[model samples]
Target: MSGRKYVTTVGVEVHVELATRTKMFCSCLNAPQGVAPNLATCPVCLGLPGSLPVINREAVRLGIVAALALNCAVNPRIWFERKNYVYPDLVKGYQISQIAMPLGERGWLAIIGDDGAEKKVAINRVHLEEDTARLAHSGDNSLIDVNRSGAPLMEIVTDAVLRSGREAEEYVRKLRAILVYNGVSRCRIQRGEMRVEANVSIAPEGAKELGVRSEIKNQAGFNHMRSAVEYEVRRQAGALDAGGTLRQETRGWDDVNQRTFVQRSKEDAHDYRYFPEPDLPPLNIDPAWVAAVEAALPTGYEDYVAGLLGQGLTAADVDALSRNDALGFLRLAASAMGDKTVLFAKRLIKDVFALANSTGVPLDESRLGPSAFRDAALLLENGKIAAEGFRTLLDVLYREGGEAERRAGENQLFVETDAGAVAEAISKVFAENPRLIEDFKNGKIAVRNALLGRTMKAVGKRADPRVVSGLLDQALQHQGRADHDRDTRLPRGKS
Candidate 1:
């Protein structure tokens, strides 16, 4: 494998389903999950005779938004093309997609590469298309669910600039984040809202010409996508070393076997028999519309992360907040909390996120809203409630909606700041641990922490830790001075 040097070239094709209320060219419901098979279909989506297609305006607008977000140039005039193919899941023999005039072209997304440098992956086009139905295969039988059919799909193709599997993974990850942030799509890989295909080829190191590329179709996850690309690279390299030839073909990834198997020869553009769709008219994207969409785009993800970091959030917290559903909530709380943003961010990561992970509920869907979160943070900040009390209140707030103060009071979780109570607790702890006091007098000052622990336990978690530490220090110091005076007086007596 090391005799001849080779460089791997990778390009990616990502398809994302738009979160629209209806399908691409019809008014049928777009809900694909949990619906009975063929329940959401209609004449247009099922491709019944005498059915004509009409464009979904909202889907087109979303596609343009995604394209602009990727920094692509939107075409002023674009039309759909019929991509002819045969498959059971494809109700229509020809897929209505774009070829000659895609919605947008020449875009790029920046991804951090293996060398830790920002690398831009060139986007070829962001086109609009319709999704195929779901195919469920049993031992020997197959079933089609048309619920997914006709859902608006966006195809984002990237130039073959990625040199490694890691880079490809990063590219797709960044792309998904951008799309999700822009509200263009949910981009959930597990839900089939997003799919990835990698076209991989290897050429001799420093060769001016590229080698034959093979397409790996529909990798379900990022790990699978990277593995498929890496496996194909090695396979091509091994074949060339053994004086065998590689062919332009399509392959499917076997997650169980951890390898790629041939599916069919790859098809070129002409193979699709592309033609203009007569049912839908050409889409006109005016400059004013493009400008409006561009202006409405959200902050770039990098900028968003940077802003979060600047707000004193740790890098780990920033990453967690950015990737999770709680991001919007965090932002809202941060804005509302003002100078206490870092405190809220920490609590969110340490408490709310941990609960969400354990309970399998997303943060955004939790009963705890931004106002309740801010109130809890304020209580903790003002020392009205200790850390344990705050945590208890947060759990209640997350599970059941209530005011933080009312919940804290109902649970008897207020911090005990009474001076007399703290003093009595310290004296009780000293009485219980006479040996600890004697050791302190003998200069074993490090044992003060043990004494503080005892005092806190005596207070039963109602006392503030800071108050307990202060009271304990005062008692020890007073005992130390008394012992010194008694020792000096006894030494003068020569006893």
Candidate 2:
């Protein structure tokens, strides 16, 4: 096995459902879930005779935006083609897609490759089309839901550049992040808003030519995609090693068994019987319109992460904020807090996020708005609220949006900042623990922490720990000095 090495080559096709108000070729609602099946259908989407297809302008705009985000060049002339295929999901025996003139071409997305270096994955094309109805099977019977039919869908094809399953997963994750950041799609994989397919093949380590490839269809999640690609790589390698030939076919991933099973023979361009759509006119994208869309694009996810790191955020914190999909909220809170972005980011990642996770709520969906979050951070930074108080205030804000400072005050959660009060608390702790004080003077320095804990407990955790510790150390020092003076005088008298 060590001597027989293989190189895995992977390319991906991603399908994203656009967040549009209506379907691609009809004015029916584009809702896919929680609606009665076959209701969001029309003559245009149902293949009824004599109904013509119309293009959705908003979908086209979103396609162009997504293309630009991936660094693709928009084609000046965009046209739709008819792809003929027979499938239960595709009601129209033929699907309207693009082959010759797509919306954009030659785009690239950056991903951290398997070798721990930044690598760019070449995108062949990003095109717009209509989605098909969904098929649900149960007990040897199948149900069709046309609510998803005719919904605007964007298909992005990548060049065969990925080298491993990890690279493929990272590419998809980064792509999904970009899409969601730009408000292009919800990208809810569980709900089928986004789907991924991997085309994988393996060749000898130094082979100059490629090997036969298999298409893995509709991996619902990133983990599933990675697993399927890796399994196929091994399966193909084993077949080649056993003097068995490989075939071009489509396969489905059985997540339960963690393997890929054959679905059908793969089809090429000729099999689709491609031709231009007769109803819709070719789209002539204006240069100015393209410029406007490009200008409107938000900052890329990588750049945003870099900026946050530059602002003194730890890599772990950035990853947390990104994975939780709270970067948008972070940006808003940062803007509200001005130069204290790092402070806010830390609190959000540590405190606010902890609360959200423990309660099974997403941070972005919580009632903690930017203003309230900013105020809480400021309170913590200024020493007006102790750690416990800050956490309590966060809970209040998460449940009901209100002024942070006011809420803290209402709950008596403010830090005990009075020096006299802290001194009194320290004195009481020292008096109650005379043995501990004696132990401390005899060089049992660890007792200092115990004394400090007692002091905080006495103060109801309202006094800042740092302040309490300082006061305790000062009182202990004074006591030690007085004891030293008394010891010296007594020694002379006894002599």
Candidate 3:
């Protein structure tokens, strides 16, 4: 028989690669983009002898901005400590990090938990550090690219409050949004700009203390991180059920094999042998500048999401907008659209987003600005352009960066509003399809849709579908009455 059920506890650490022009402590270019190996290095980034480290003021400012965005309290005096670790990628024998006095602490953010309610996850600290070099391993060779070395990295650590894989995923998703919305970091998980580490443990049901956790290190994808957490939970529960003792250890996720494997024993704080940096002095944050940063913030992430939901956007749509960094664009379009907000949202999500995805271009990089989208959506809403015409206009505007109204006219995509032209198209379609006409008069009323399609095709797809349907219905009714009258005449005087 199995023992009592277990409960999961998770703590996540998110590493964000701060966006800046230079390295954290040096003037070397912070080029994560493809730069030749060793080209972006300097003495400070490389930790050469006789070199000194200087903090980047802009990096400090951005850190403060992020801290305020996360509702963390800024420390007046913060300093760096050398985290002593020996590895091939570490140019120096130690890393300059902050734990004794970090930039921010005691923050809390909300996420929608597994129970479909708002959950407040406590944040322990948000600190700034430098990234290590990238390691690429082949079958027989290992290489290090120092371009990522000494880049600015910010870490956010959460308390052990998450209960499930989904809660952990939600926490990361919401954190990403809050950071991106505040212009903190790009948080691109694909590019290694953002990374996640989860500490998962499971305890007996109604236990008073937490169980020993295995740290899952450097999960680059959100779903992979969730999977690692869930798998670790199950593994721990199985071991405990079989009367096996769990140990504290660090592990790596084998994404291909879908399991966690031991990497090393978990390190205690003493293992790093942290000591204060003797070269660089302590950091002092200005209250005035922090005030300005708080003042300059655009809007809170929670409020923005709430407003988007109030506009009837689904949660998935909001996620798409946030992930693509197009929330501001949608907001601008909605600001001017009034009651047509839904139409604008639909067009932005359905049409504009499709173009971006298909072409491998970002939505914000497109020439279809909010005003352009607004004009196009209005054309569709006001019956000036057919649905087919609107799509054509969108394709053109997205490709060539032209005004929607001008392009619609240039391409002759506007609906054929001329009564005579519509009637002629309808009459030609009726004359072309006698079999369909017979079907209509014989009570196969669904033939009206075919007539409508043929009419639009005759007009080069610029005819409004509503107008085509109305005219086709009237023509079919007239033909049906004529056929009825002839049938009632009793075969040439038999009546």
Off by over 4 Å in 2: 1-5, 205-208, 332-340, 358-495
lDDT per residue for candidate 3 within 156-212, as digits (tens), equals 999999999889998998888787766678777877888999999999988999999
Per-prediction TM-score to the true structure, in the order listed: 0.77, 0.75, 0.75
Please give the lDDT score for candidate 2: 0.87
- Tens-digit lDDT track for model 2 on 1-495? 345889899999999999899999989989745668898788998989999988988999999899999999999998999999999999999888898999999999988788888899999999998999999999989999878888999999999999988899999999998887776787888878899999999999899988899999999899999999999998998888888999999999999999999999999999999998998889999999999998876567677788888878889988898787777677777763246878888888888889888888777567888889988888888888888788989999898778998889898888887889989888899889999988777777778889988888988757787788888889888877788887842111211
Q: Model 1, 77-165: lDDT tens per residue? A: 99999999898888889899999999999999998878899888899999999999999999899988888889999999999999999
Each candidate: what lDDT?
Answer: 0.86, 0.87, 0.85
lDDT of 2 at 98: 91
Give the candidate number with the greatest TM-score. 1
Residue range with the least summed lDDT across 10 consecutive positions in model 3: 486-495
